[model samples]
Target: MSIVQRFSKIFFYLALFPAVIVLCAWQGWAWWSWATAPPAPKSSTGETSDADKTVQIRIPPGSTSKQIGSYLESAGLIRSSNAWDLWVRWLNTQNKGVFKAGTYELSPTQSLKEIAEQISQGSVVQISFTIPEGRNLKQMAAYFESQGFFPAQDFLAATKQIPRDKFPWLPSGLPHLEGFLYPDTYQIASGGITPKAVIDIMLKRFEQVALPMYQKNPQQIKLNLLQWVTLASIVEKEAVIPAERPRIAGVFTQRLQKGMKLEADPTVEYGLNIQQTVDQPLTFKQVKTPSPYNTYLNRGLPPTPIASPGKASLQATLNPEKTDYLFFVARYDGTHVFSRTLAEHQAAVAAIRKQRVQQNQGAIPQPN
Candidate 1:
């Protein structure tokens, strides 16, 4: 080769080498920024509103990394889908993990790496729901429906079809999952959450929280699971004051031991599916009306639990306060007056009614 041609070739090689190095440096900087930087906020007024704060993006099952990236980009949760694809490829090479399928609550302020990691780790959006104590299965359904969780009928239907296969500890021949569902706050995954899933969670909670107490048999109560829950449900409905649970439970226990009718007002209401307001208390006619759940007319516990009892009521039923109290009457206040005999109970009831009448006539309230 000629000297001129060789010199030209050397210069070309040197120039090409520098250009390649600069290109590589630029690419590295771009990738670094893309990985670490969050998407720019789209608020024109320079303030993040509630809508712009967070977005819910669903990653469908069997979605490829590219598809997830595209979704994130469209939702304004990420800067670029191309960058996401490249980052995901790199993650695959490192065997970090696969992105799971679920609804994700993501914010635009989160970096690409943070969002990707969360998805990969299956950190799905969770919705917290609470079941207050003493709520019946029907009431629970209504509440769930009102909260947009599902249809009231769906929840009710799911309760009827108990998944005994998943929960072997569930009592056999359980007509419906009434008292079995634990009453407490629950964190449920946002997407694809069915009524069955919610029921399973609640039953699992019951198994975890309340079942252990029964297994321990601390009180050595002779009642089976059904009966224990039945009595607890009654206690839950009857007790207004938290401190009165044990005493109320004691009254029922004495009634049961003596083979006397419970005649609990709550049982009568449950059977009739009616709540007695202060202005309209349980009438004699209502109490006299016979139903399977009416403790007033029935001899023993109702066929099933009237409502879902909380931990306190369950505990109170298991370990009742030792007392001779066979009867009790509500004073319209949260407190109830306990009596050793029917005469005392009747007197207490009369006194409360008289006091209530006086209060209605603008008279001073008397102490129970």
Candidate 2:
């Protein structure tokens, strides 16, 4: 038609073309979203088999999220690194890069989302080990080594490196850390556990449990923290029955109060480097051994604790049983009879010997 009419028509077409393109683009985006959005993951069920991509990923200390994600993918615990990264970012966990260094047991049944959540939340596998009361440091070190916590030599070396000043409770110039490592079951990660870390945790536990007792009755007992621990250690090793601990502690306390030699067999054994039960009765020569730890000569608690003490022994030290008994001997059964006089102690020992003789006769004799 006319020029003005043609120009108006062209402008209208141009504008309409842009609107059509905009509408198409919007529709395309909607279609793409529908196609690409992931399906809601199925809730894990009992039917899931253990064989489904089960892997243990060890995220060592100081590892970054990128490193952790790559490790999971390599271990086949997750399907895609991108998915895991996005899932971790969305969770906004405080454990951002602080994934506790550990050997985590992971399963293939777990989605990338679940795996990421677990890692970020420190859902790592835990290993537990218990140190029984009365165990010496060497025994404790052996137990740790057996549990794969650390090398036994490493534990021993770490004890040497421990600063005496830091632990004022410890006696000076001690050859090794013997009775100080408190005995208790501990939960720790199976990976990245250093010797120092293990020792530090045990020492802290010791302080938490034993320090208060020392503070409460320091002077009344007339023993320093280390001396108290030393006495408690002897009590731990000597008393087989739980009920007898207080009585044994009382005997020691009485001897200490009277300035009499402790003459403890365990102390003599410790001096002689003999930890097991002696086949023969202790002789005067055994008691006369020249060691700083020999209670027979020292006339008090040894330089340090003979072994680590448990709560019962510690309590016995704090509250000794009031008894006139000064000597005790183990009966053939798992018990001990106490006596006050030397004559009474001799009679009890004779009775125990007689019982042992009868027990031997009662048993079936092996072909000799």
Separate clash counts for every candidate: 0, 2
Query: Model 1: which ten-residue window has the lowest total lDDT?
Result: 34-43
**Residue pairs in collision within model 2:** 53-108, 230-305
Output the TM-score of candidate 2.
Answer: 0.74
Predicted candidate 2 versus true structure: per-residue lDDT over 129-240, tens digit per residue = 7889998877778888897777898888888775566667666777777777889988776664777777777888888887776777534356767778888999998999
Q: Per-residue lDDT for 151-270 in model 1, tens only?
A: 999989989997889988777888899898899999988765789899989999999999998889677357888899999999999998999999898888888988999988888998
Please report the TM-score between candidate 1 and the true structure: 0.79
Off by over 4 Å in 1: 1-37, 41-71, 82-101, 218-221, 363-368
Best by TM-score: 1
Worst lDDT run of 10 residues, candidate 2, spans 34-43
lDDT of each: 0.89, 0.76
TM-score of each: 0.79, 0.74
